[model samples]
Target: MDTPLINALEALKKENRISFHTPGHKKGRAYESMDDGGIQENLYQYDTTEVFGTDQLQDPTGAIKESQQWTARVFQSPEAYYLVNGSSAGVLAMILSQTKPGDEILLPRDVHQSVIHALILGDLTPRFIQPEIDPQFKIPKGITLPQVQEGLEKYPKCKGVLLTHPNYYGRPGEIREIRRMTREFGKILWVDQAHGAHLGLHPQLPLSGIDAGADLTVTSFHKTLPAMTQSAVLFAGGEVVDRERLLEQLNMHQSSSPSYILLASIEQGTRHYAKAGKEKMQVLLEAIESFEQKFRRLGLFQLDTAPGKDRTKIWIHTENSGRTGHEVETYLRENHGIDMEFSMPQGLLALTSIGNREKDLKKLYLAFEELEETLYNKVKMEKFSEKYSKEAKEGFFEKEVERDKKEPLGLPIRTAFYSRKERVSINKSVNRVAGSAVTPYPPGIPLILPGEAITRGHRDQLLEYEKRNIKVIGIKAGKIMVVAEE
Candidate 1:
């Protein structure tokens, strides 16, 4: 009998679209481009389960152990563990290992949704550090050193500070200064280095979290490195993380029957980086620079050139082209057959890596050039209203006012989460404790987190959501969730 899964795989192979998306190796060229035929064949052969030669992932004392050691050496970390689960697991493990319930942690507002989930699961109190916002681009920038200093001062008893380095948009923060601030405050600096797996390979690239004095850092190998999906690494610095506790936490979160394919892919990807990552990345950077020039000439989309941003992760704002990022993304996928990483309301992101070929990028440049010629003259660019953008910015800060209050919503998150919550009208929910997190997904910082009392400003933001027809979760048809009690 023909299986549907096999049929889907065959269909995917038939499409043969250029992937400007993930797994780093766009078209399996890294493996196919190998000089040694025997090595390439062996690579494919060992991509199997825990068979005769291949050992189990959890109790790795053979090839997997060796691979982990090599990875640690390459990244210059004291110890590293292969994360069969993505860096999300590693982030949760690290946080759970260190702190207990009621322990306060300072988190950057721009942190990934996974971190927020960890906070909820661990029942940890979170004090947010607002990252600088680039109003012109409508993108949040990195956490400033002063912000870290201020957070530590404000929450002197807080257990740790969690940061997302080289944020999703690829903006790198001043790690050295932030490290100094954390050290002075005697707080463990846990870094979410998910988007920076390849940083250690090239010195010219942004500094790796480990080098910047992070206590524990997690890297998603599949993001910028040539690893299989869900393969990541958790790195620990000297005398910072408790090894025994970390191992126990890993066991708690990680799978018992971890995928051998993902574990082995970590080894192969690390080896590839150690051998030729810098050289390959240099070549890729050069190609990207040339492509940016070509796109500028076409005037299709304007690239975001914020200082210290990752050159490889190209972000292009298409609002000026009379199209939303979603429209451009749909056009590229359906018409041009080009797949991208993500498309925000404001812009589209095309992620490049060492594994991308010259031919692949040429296709992207050519496609954009043709698209520009066809649409630029016909479509009049709509100037995005500064008023709407300003209101959104003001709304974000207004949410923070409730978050910072001394008796802010005075209820435990878990208690509120699983409690007999009732749906109340947005206006009626004013001054009532929130039973959920309601915020924009791209930034993902909650405007109304569990236990935070809703205010008029909160009501205003929610009303704006209704005006724009944006879906608000944990609410019944525009009604907000509040504690069922009086």
Candidate 2:
């Protein structure tokens, strides 16, 4: 069979690489401990639609309703809805349901691109809140209490606030304080907790959005939990949530025929979390600590101990090692057969979960040692300056071109997105309205949003990212789409 994707996947599977990434089952190893009735082995047979015994996802009444109710209880939400389209659909649904067309919503600048898409879909205006950036990581850390207060105060008419808890490297902000402030303002607080499904399972971990008093929350079961990809759950709590409207939005965004395989995995994952997830998380945490200790003793490859850091996310700094994180990631893959979640210029993030074994940590540690030795022999640590070459470092501007100072009343996202646009060279696009969002995946935060005027800073940063081989979503060739003048 001429199945390149399948063949490649099979070949990758044959190599038996240790996973520190997601769909958190770690290639279905977590399923081995489950007492599932051969469902893991025969998942294909259960892939049927809304027939006799099977229930509809759109308007759940039978088994699906019971399953959702159980999950809601497990997560301590007043209501829970299963989503097979992943957290993106849940995010869109949350936005559309909460705000009317042209209504404004308060959100962080570092929100996932899906939130921007929701703005386009709902014709909603975004009141952007600026999160404090990690000086070392060059990524937005998380929204602070003052930032949320200022955002809400500045955009008093905005329907509510939206935030991503434990921003991608798994560091949580002051969510409880932010939640209290949102409540005092008599506004809704919606949380995009896509990377935090395993939170609240352990006391050491940060509280889940539902637990932190968010009016609405969406979590991906597949990210840090043992579930099939594309499975997520939308949680609704507090008096502010419009349950009926939220359900309608879910129906609109989700597929008519949801995958039974995904639904089954969500259910199984819920059971696993309730039954065995806690103990396994404890073990994973201990393993992570031990792994960090090895590097700590050697005084190499420092682990990120950012305040309120989720120890599960191992952010190993390679800045002093004379190799870029991207370079280290490739070396690990080629030499050690170890997979990482993502990499920035400074470091690689290993998204450890309950699925990861102690042996996997040991393998990663050994790989790190080898990488350090290789780098030490080839290049002097002092000689390798600027993180990524000097030019690249200068190009990777930390600020967002005074985005925080800009008013939220730029051209509406939908208007600019649907407007007639023409492709122009990246250099020529400066000062023109962006026709689409230019985002970098892995983190998936937009650098240039639809309706925003492209700045010289945006152009320069994007060109540098391209030169360094970073994937920019909206660029094709060396041009970008800009709103055409009449």
Candidate 3:
């Protein structure tokens, strides 16, 4: 049979690779303990449209509404809605419902690409608050109270604020404080908690956005919960959100025919969360702690840590060992049959969930132990030092420091996005208006946004990413899309 994707997936399944990645069911093992009423066993049979028994997702009145109500109760939100289109639709709805066209909204510059799409679709202007960067990981953390205070004070007439809690690397910021500030200023607070569905499941984890008093919050069930892909939930609470307007945007952004299978999986996932999430989370955390303690005893590995970082997400750094994360990731896959969530220049990330078992952590620890033992006797790898020079490293971090200073926007996001564009080399496009966003996937934060004026710093950082062979979305054959001049 000429089934390329299915064949590959089946082959990989046969390989029994250890997963520290998403679609958080760990290859459907979570379903084994779930009380799914045969939904997991007969997924094909359950695939159907809105019929007599099935209620409409947009205007839920029957079973769907009941399910969502149960979910809201479980998550401690005032009202909850299921989304088959993932958190992207929920993010768009949040923006469109809160503000009108040409109105300005305050948000972090490190927002997911969906936030930029919302700006384009709503014909709105953005007042970006730069997020603080982690000095060790070189990844953006979360918005601070001072940054938000400055943005709101500078753009006093801005409609509201949108924030991404636990920004991709699992470090949460001051959502509680920011929520209070927004209320005092009579502004709405919307949270993109796409990677924090497991929060509040355990006492040790950081507070969930809903619990932090966000007026609106969107969480992806698939990211850290035992839900199928594209399954998510949006919560509406507090006094700021316009309920009627939010419902309108929900319908506008979501599909007319939502997936029944996805809905079933969400319901089943929610059931698991309600039943066994805490117990299993405790087990998973203990396992991870044991793995960390064991690996740290090896005396040759480094683990990334922050004050409020999620313990479920582990980052293994090879900088001290003189190997790039990309190199270590390749070695793991080829030698240890393990897959990670993502790899950066500094380290590889492993996203754990309730679905992960103790054995999984044991496997990871064994792999790292073997890697260190095997490489300890050999001469130190010079590729990292040769490739990343001291001057280049300084420039890379210098670009991050420069992000604290606001760059000029050449045109409004909506106008620049719809305008005609021409392809130009990355270096030649500096100071010209960007026609599209240059974003890296996995973390999905845009380095350059549409309608923003390109700077020499942007050019140098992107060039460095290219030299490191990172995958960026907007560049093709070394050319970038810039708005054509008259």
Candidate 4:
């Protein structure tokens, strides 16, 4: 029987698009020279149900145990668990394992959507700590030590501090300093190191979460390593995180019938990292540096960078290309046959990994060159400030929560998410307690949480997002559904 997913993937291949995007493998062609000897095929063979030798993921005792042990060693962590559900699972697990209901946790405003869901799931109050945003590119940067200190001073009762190291844009924060602050404040340091999975493998790269004093760190192995999609790892460090509690939470959040294919991919990817990752990543870095030199010469786009950020993930914003990220993404895919990892309103990003080769980099350079010529000759440069500007000057990172006298429209997210609920419009949602969390997708943090009073600022942001076709969850009729008074 033919599967729809498989058929669709085949159709995509038929389209012959050049993948500048993900799996970091780029159509599985870039890593062909690696001495896999078809070990990847062997891995596929073992992707079976939990048999006699294959152990269950939740209670690993056999091959899974060995794999997890190997992974721990690879990352230099006290222990590591292969997460079949992606880094999102590991993040949620950390939150659930560490905090209790009504407890406060310090979270960076620029964190992924998963963290917001985790906060709602755990019934924890988030003390939002803003990240530093580059004035030029409007890209969010890492939080500073002073900011962490101030947050800890203000919210001393916070149970933990959740930070994203090497944020989605590839800006690496000073993790060591942040970790020190968290420890001094007697709070756990939970790092979302989704983009830094390859850090430990390369000595020249920025430090990994495990090495930088993070208590519990989650990495999306699939993002930067040669792992299958949805494969991730959660590393436990120091005495901050209770390992047993983490294991229990992981079992709860992770799937019982875990995919052995994804597990084996992690195993193989870790082994690859242990053996040849350094040399491979070195070559990858060299290729990127070379590409940057050529990219600067073209001069149609400005590549955003921050001090101490990992150089592998290159984020490009057009200077006068007069195109939204959507338009540039379309131009690459339709005209140049190239696809990138993500195209936000501000810029387009290309994630380079050990999986990339000289030829792959060359192809990207050629595409950019063509893109420059096409935009210069055919497209009139459109100023994007008016189109992409934030709805309110209320800083994305620095916004403060104000308590309103309005009654809640719905129960807290913890209850509303698990309960049967219906959608409502934004205007009608004013007095009701929110039944769900409504957030912006790219940096998926909730603008409105369940049980929080809906302010006009929140409404305006949602409306602006709607105008731009940005989707918001837990709402109906341009309003959000909330718990009604019985």
RMSD of each: 4.8, 2.7, 2.4, 4.5
Best by lDDT: 3
**Tens-digit per-residue lDDT, 1-486, candidate 3:** 699999999999999888889989988877667656467778888888899989989899999999999999999999998989899999999889988998999998888999999999999999988777667666677788999899999999988989888777787878889988999999988899998988988878878889988999999999899988999999998786898899899999888999999998888878899889998899888898888888877655687667778889888866565556777787778778888888766667888898888988898888888778766765444423455435435454456456545587888888999999998999899899999998876677788889989998888877877887889999999989989999
lDDT (10s digit) by residue, model 4, range 1-486 = 679999998989999776655575555653565544354667667668988989889888888998899889877888888999999999999889988889988877667778878877788877777676676766777877888888889989999888888887888777888888787778898899988889886666777789996889999888888877888999888686777888999999899899987887788778778888888888988888888888887766777755577888888875345455656776677666777877655577888888877877788888789878766675533522443334223343222222112233345557766656566777556655666777665445566666666666666556656775765665555767666556
Superposed Cα RMSD, model 3 = 2.4
Error (Å) of candidate 3 at residue 194 is: 0.5
- The C-alpha stretches of model 2 lying farther than 4 A from their native spots are 35-37, 298-300, 379-410
- TM-score: model 4 vs. ground truth: 0.86
Cα misplacement distance, residue 472 of candidate 1 (Å): 8.8
Error of 2 at 199 (Å): 0.3
lDDT, model 1: 0.76
lDDT of each: 0.76, 0.83, 0.84, 0.75
Model 1 CA lDDT for position 337: 85
Task: Look at candidate 3 and tell me the lDDT of residue 90.
Answer: 93
lDDT of the structure predicted as candidate 4: 0.75
The residue pairs found clashing in candidate 3 are: none
Q: After aligning candidate 1 to the native by TM-score, how far in Å is the CA of 161 from where it should be?
A: 1.2
In candidate 3 the C-alpha lDDT for residue 478 amounts to 92
lDDT of 1 by residue, 215-297 (tens): 99999998887877898999998476788888888888898878766776787788888888878888888898888787778
Query: Which portions of model 4 miss their true places by more than 4 Å?
Result: 1-4, 35-44, 379-422, 425-434, 439-448, 451-486
Give me the runs in candidate 1 sitting further than 4 Å from their true place.
Answer: 1-9, 35-56, 298-300, 379-411, 422-448, 452-486
TM-score of 3: 0.93
